[model samples]
Target: MPVSSPQIINMGCRLNLAEGESIRALLAGRDTIVINSCAVTNEAVKQTRQAIRRARREKPDAELVVTGCAAQIDPASFAAMPEVNRVIGNAEKLKSEAWEAYDAVLVQDIMAVRETAPHLAASFSTHARAFVEVQNGCDHRCTFCAIPYGRGNSRSVPAGAVIDRVAALAANHGEVVLTGVDLTSYGPDLPGSPSLGQLVERILHHVPQLRRLRLSSLDGVEIDDRLFALLTQEPRLQPHVHLSLQAGDDMVLKRMKRRHGRAESVALVERLRAARPEIAIGADLIAGFPTEDEAMFANTRALIDDCDIVHAHIFPYSPRAGTPAARMPQVEPAIVKARAARLREAAAARRSRWLQSLIGSAQQVLVERPGDRGHAGNFAEVRVPPSETGEIVTVTIKAVQEGKLIA
Candidate 1:
């Protein structure tokens, strides 16, 4: 439904951001668009709610829609709000009869394991970077995660469809990042058991102009020799990988039912480094789970320090209501906070070390937004001499300042 005024909002992750942009295109005829959502932590939930209130104040009678994971998981709370006209879960609001009532609509559909082909064409991103969701849903039921329950099973759109979308995105001067609930799980139900490597090869071959093709999080256990070899051959593939390492302690990993533990995870990172020395590796770490004590937390810190990780996402364990970890003995908030502080310090140190390594090295940077001073890239911030916002520039790192590289 096109309205003289319309706003769409999203919460959480790059994958969710991509879907929100798609929804914006679907409702493009609307004169105004506002996205009010994100759900990384409880704090993000507060930020999203405030964004919704602000949007209501700005566009009093504008059509409004609230979707994505946060809205899908908790529609009733959103529906009770005075500003929300309708709340649909997943993408179900697109099919709602009540959509006619307001100039805008909100949909909350049950997260499905699979996705039907999108009816709308791919969005031409105005930003230098665009994210393409190659897969959705998770088959692994991690004890601490509510993701499998929120987003059904693993499913993938056809490889051809993904390439077509990338082509369109590339035409608009954007680098494409393949994202999903678990990107390594892509192509499970698709024809011929197409591998993630095959998908990367196809996209690189077809869309040669694509500035960069980055992969989202992948499972360390699933990293095979074939995939590693493909990375060496495909120069377009980004040298960065964000492996999901929820816990480094074996007992904690077993409780979480993660497929891999510290030893194997460490090996995978080593393999990647051996194959590509310049690779930037990152991982996700959880602190203070039900099974995590000071010893377990220490083990995690040691593993991260030894793993040669370029960066880390440190999160305190939040017990989602229905997860197995929630039913287990919960950690004290005080303990979680302390562990998180330690991990944050470690992560910052590693990030600074990685930035230092980039000094005097030339890197291809896809310029994002123009900052007050200059532009930001994957590695560091640069003050381009008379920098233009959208252009991709090659620059040599002149120095390492604080935690970022200066060019």
Candidate 2:
């Protein structure tokens, strides 16, 4: 295949975006169409297929390549697709040599790989802010999750390498978001087994020019004391924290094999708020889990008010094959969809109330692009006058319209 400009269609978490950037950098000026797929849910898999078809239709001459969790889990399924010419695994996708010698499907068992290398991207093509991958994979086996099978074991990039990458990005990018499969599970694989907080401290110490540092989704139970202290002391660290609180009910959490309970999650939120009064909190909540009754669902609904979760990513339970939850007593599809909608409604109300509170407050908005739409330190969407794409500017909240802060 003649080397031409590569087109990458990335779907899924911040970590995927970060990996896609690296893949883009590796396949620069190549005539390849890479569809980075996600298998987080059945819908995600369907979306990946849709994206592949769309990519093929748009660029008929381009060579289609598939990779990421979806492809990693089911390589043969993607390979059988007529639109796809090649399928690669999660680990293989990061290697330059894999792309260099890309002729056939090359996917290996992810579990066999023990170490994670820091795959640094020259720049990000999708967003203004740069996401640096600090860790990869998961060690925990949540009953509902099939991610560990695709992503393999938890592994961390050495803290020094991470600091270097952050420093490099700090030179050009105002904000650097640290991303990973299991972000809070970082550093357990390293030699000293330094904590995520230690890595944050190193980045702060080394990269003084970096304006803001943000974190991707974190497991509440994995948060160390050092990180909690930083939450209180560090102003450069973004005030918003998105926790991976899958369920709010204690029994449901136990069924999910999650580490944190309802009380623990609530206490963590309260502690974070006490440390930083203006801090905004977000969470990932599942609407209908296996064996969840009306009372259990009500606990999840009440958690929105209890935790003050203004921003939420609510997912209705979808049983993935090979997971323990797939064999459990299932919630009806209609009930799941309805519960998801209700959860979304509740989240919107909480978000509206939070935005209303911020109506008269001054905010520092990081301009994502020229249209004056950007995100505040607390991850609230803000609209202001036109500014430089990557510049951070101060704006006063004038009103809330259409669920966004207007300045």
Question: How does candidate 2 score on lDDT?
Answer: 0.91
Taking all chains together, each candidate's TM-score versus the true structure is: 0.90, 0.98
Consecutive 10-residue window with the lowest summed lDDT within model 2: 117-126
User: Which residue ranges in model 1 land beyond 4 Å of their true spot?
Assistant: 1-6, 31-40, 93-113, 116-121, 371-383
Question: What TM-score would you give candidate 2 relative to the actual structure?
Answer: 0.98
Model 1, span 1-407: residue lDDT tens: 53453455556677776766666665656654444354445666677788778888988877556655666666678777887665545544333243344533344344442573363236735466777888877888888887655566787879998998888888775467788888898786898998887788788888888877778888877766667876655667767778899888999999988989789988887877887887777789998989688898888988777787666888888888677888998789999989989988888888787787778888766666652223233434565444555566777878876555667
Best by lDDT: 2
Runs in model 2 lying further than 4 Å from the true structure:
1-3
Worst 10 residues of 1 by lDDT: 371-380
Position 202, candidate 2: lDDT: 91
Error of 1 at 360 (Å): 1.2
Q: Estimate the overall C-alpha local distance difference test score of candidate 1.
A: 0.71
lDDT of 2 by residue, 89-155 (tens): 9999999889877566899999998877557777865576999999988989999999998899998
